[model samples]
Target: MKKFDKERLLLAVAGPVIALVAAMVLTSVVLVASGKSPVEPYSLMFQQATYSDVQVLIINEAGMYYLAALAVAVGFRMNLFNIGVDGQYRLAAMVTAVVGAHMSLPAGLQIPLLIVVAMLTGAFWAGIAGVLKTTRGVSEVVSTIMLNAIATSVIAYLTLDDKFGVPVGNNNTTGVMHESGWFPGIDMGDSGEIYGFVVVAALAGVLYWLILNRTRFGFDLRATGASQSAAAASGVNAKRMMLTAMLVSGAVAGLAGMPILLGDVHTYSLSFPTGLGFTGIGIALLGRNSPVGIALASLLWAFLVKASQALDYEGYDKEIAVIMQGLIVIAVVVSYEGVRRWGLRRQQQRVGEELAAAARAAGDENNGNNDSVKEVAAR
Candidate 1:
């Protein structure tokens, strides 16, 4: 095949293969140091995860992770690190839940409305960071991190008191949303219910792929990420691209909490989940920010989490999974860098060889002409 195609194929195969190998080696070392055999723990984890109920749980968790990762992936593509996704989703979910709780619209309308509310709120929160970066020369990473702290305080204030909070027995929460706003869960035979919102998460992935691979906006975003100066020279508005990418990322992050909110909890409680946004960052890096890659990475992460739950029963530490995950992330980063270096070396070698061949061909042609001229002179 062509050199570029071959290089692409090699990178695709090499990165994950090398990363997995390195992770396994490191994890094995850890296990040995802990006085445990790596084989038995892994086998037990996998076997337990194979159970029907656990499989559903894995998918359910993956659905949420899928959305979060996609959100992070969007910002990553634009060279924007939107660390505020944690806050964006929490605030979005809180506002959407409160609004949804009060609305009595039909299911068809209410569900979409709540989703739109999520997107809008998430975009608005993220937009703050985008605006700061574009207009004030603020670093997005710093702005977003600060925004997350603010969002947490805001969510706490709104959800903790009677002003927006509803009393449910002894708990304070955004009152339960009506059935109309709930996404029905899908029942798997002998397994627990899977979140129906998984379909939405899947659709989000499709949209992400389409936008990144098929749209001018995506092209601009990627171009900007590759090199802001080059993109600016090409007349692409780098600031605008960054802002738009950040907004879109936040909008997508709004969906991150929906699986739990609509499928299971049906309310925004004090215990509403957090940290998935941070997890998304790791997953995005692991997946290399590709939509398909992120999906697989999400599943793998979910499996590790779900399977590890049984470790406690087996007298093994559940934190082992966390350790393994950390190792995998580190290894994957090293592997990608190595692959990049190897590719650069190969490309240089190829260019050098081509140049040498061309020089030899030119020398041969020039020598032949000189010999022909000499023969004519001698004759």
Candidate 2:
């Protein structure tokens, strides 16, 4: 249709498609080098992932990944890389677990309180980086990476034997939360109960889209991302938007763990999931930071995760999935750049063609006028 629409297609559709293709090709090569048939392993992965239990697991895991992707997307839209989401989420979950364990609030109130505590804890942790970036000119990337290390130490200190830690077998945990704080899930019969928090994650996605695509603050966030100086010239207060974006991202990151905390584990323990924040970065990139895109990306990620385990049982290395994931992440970056350059080239070609057509039309008009003038001179 329009040139702008064409360029957007390259971004929203073409990039992911190209990335998937490239990742698959590279993964196949890896399998071939290992003296294995690439097709068989993939076929097995897909077939095994079709089982009912695995499907349930994929959906449940996708819920968590979707939340994390949304969190990363928030910062992504503002050109902020909040690498400390790992720390932010861990600290938030730990602190929220402690609160949920100790508090004895009424029904509904306890869950809300714990969720609030999580969001606030995540925000506070991320805010330290925000404050450093805006006030002291420290790079968020450096500060956030450092924050993750600091968060681990802080969690360790808080969970010390003589402190809030409750020894559960070989590991320490922030004792199980009261039943009042537990979120209910939908029963899937033999498959398993799908995390109730999945519904919340979906709602969060909708809210994210609305905020980014339908609000002025979103416009400011995007503007700042595109060009901080330009946004500043337009009176958008770029620094404030940057800080706000980081805090919002952290707030969302806190929710990434709730599906496990409230729906399954009901506590913060050494077994709590980690590296999810890093995973979210890849999902966000693969999804191109769109709400729908992120959802699909999370599903694909979860599918690979569930299917990869099946590989181990089949005498195949489960690390194949990890290699694919790594390649996909790398391909996403390359594909985006490639598509962007292609779009630019296409746009230039279109402009050149239009200008050439206009020039030809002008030449025809001039020739016709000249002929008419010669006729008059002849007469």
Candidate 3:
């Protein structure tokens, strides 16, 4: 394979493998410290993984998680840390639920409309931060973080009031969406199985990949991401790119919440978000900010979550999963940076070698020409 391809392959494999090894070592140390065998908990987790229902649950949850991770990954590529994805997602879900609950459109129109409105809501919410950063000279990091708090407050207010409140008492939640807005599940028959949101997740992964790899817009976004000053100098419009990237990221995140709102809960509630946006950062890092990588990372996370839930039946603490996740994230972060630096060093060395070789070739050609001149003079 070409050097570039090899470098990509190395990057693709290094982080997750290193993370797995590190997580294993950490789990072993934890078990030893706790005076328990690591083997038992892992064995139980493995056992749970074999169940059909558990597998379905993992796939479903992973699909949702993948959407969130993709959203975060987009911002990461632009060197923008979008910490307010949770709020963007929540606001979108709220808007979707409210629209779905009140709209009298047919099923075909209502579902699509709800999805579009949700995406727009998320985009608008994120645009606020972008505008603040571009127009007011605020740091996107600070603005996004503050926006998350603001979104939470707004959602709380909307869901707590009787006119806007869901029937779920004083809790902050919107009323259930109408049947027209619900996503349809596929029946697998006999096996008591249903294909859930995995299809949406797969499509999302493809969409993200295409957007990044094939589009002119994506090229401009990546250019700005790599170097905002350079991009601006080249007439790429850096501020607009940043704002567009954030809006697109928010839209993706908004779609991420739809699985929970339309499929799992059938409504928007205070509990709708459930920290998936925060978890997405870990997933994005673990996946190395690639679409396929993020999808696989999400699947791995979903597996751990499902395995953790089974701990209740096996008489083990569910917190073990969280600890394992933390360990994995740390491992991936360290390894990714290490590998990236190593790759850069290697590239620099190769470039230096190529330049030296060219210089030597030029010197040899000059020497040969000198010899020819000397011989001709002697003749």
Best by lDDT: 2
Candidate 3, residue 22: the lDDT equals 89
Look at candidate 1 and tell me the lDDT of residue 35: 96
Score candidate 1 by lDDT.
0.91
Q: Model 3 over residues 1-379: C-alpha lDDT tens digits?
A: 9988988788679878989888988977897798877778888888988887787778778888898898899998888899888888888888889888888688889878988998899899999988887788788789888888998888778877666786565456677788888887655554233435567868888988898889988888888999999998989998889899899989888888887677767777756656888889999989888887888889899999988887777767778888999999899888888888988898899899999999999999999999999999999
lDDT per residue (tens digit) for residues 1-379 in model 1: 9978988888877887788788878888889998999788889888988799988989999999999999999999998898888999999999999998888799999999999999999999999999999999999999999999999889878876667888777778998899999998898877879999999999999989998899988899999999999999999999999889989999999999999999999999878889989989888888889888888889989999999999999899988889888888888889999999998999899899999999999999999999999999999
- Judged by lDDT relative to the true structure, which candidate is superior, 1 or 2? 2
Better of 1 and 3 by TM-score: 1
Residue runs of model 2 more than 4 Å from their true location after superposition: 1-7, 361-379
Question: What's each prediction's TM-score?
Answer: 0.95, 0.95, 0.93
Runs in model 3 lying further than 4 Å from the true structure? 169-172, 189-196
Off by over 4 Å in 1: 1-3, 371-379
lDDT of 2 by residue, 1-379 (tens): 9867866765679999999999999999999999988898899989978898898999999998999888888888999999988999999999989998999898579988988999999899989999999999999899999999999999999998798999989999999999999999999999899999999999999999998989999899999999999999999998899899999999999989999998999989899999889999999999999999999999999998888897878878989999999999999999999888988888799899999999999999999999999999999
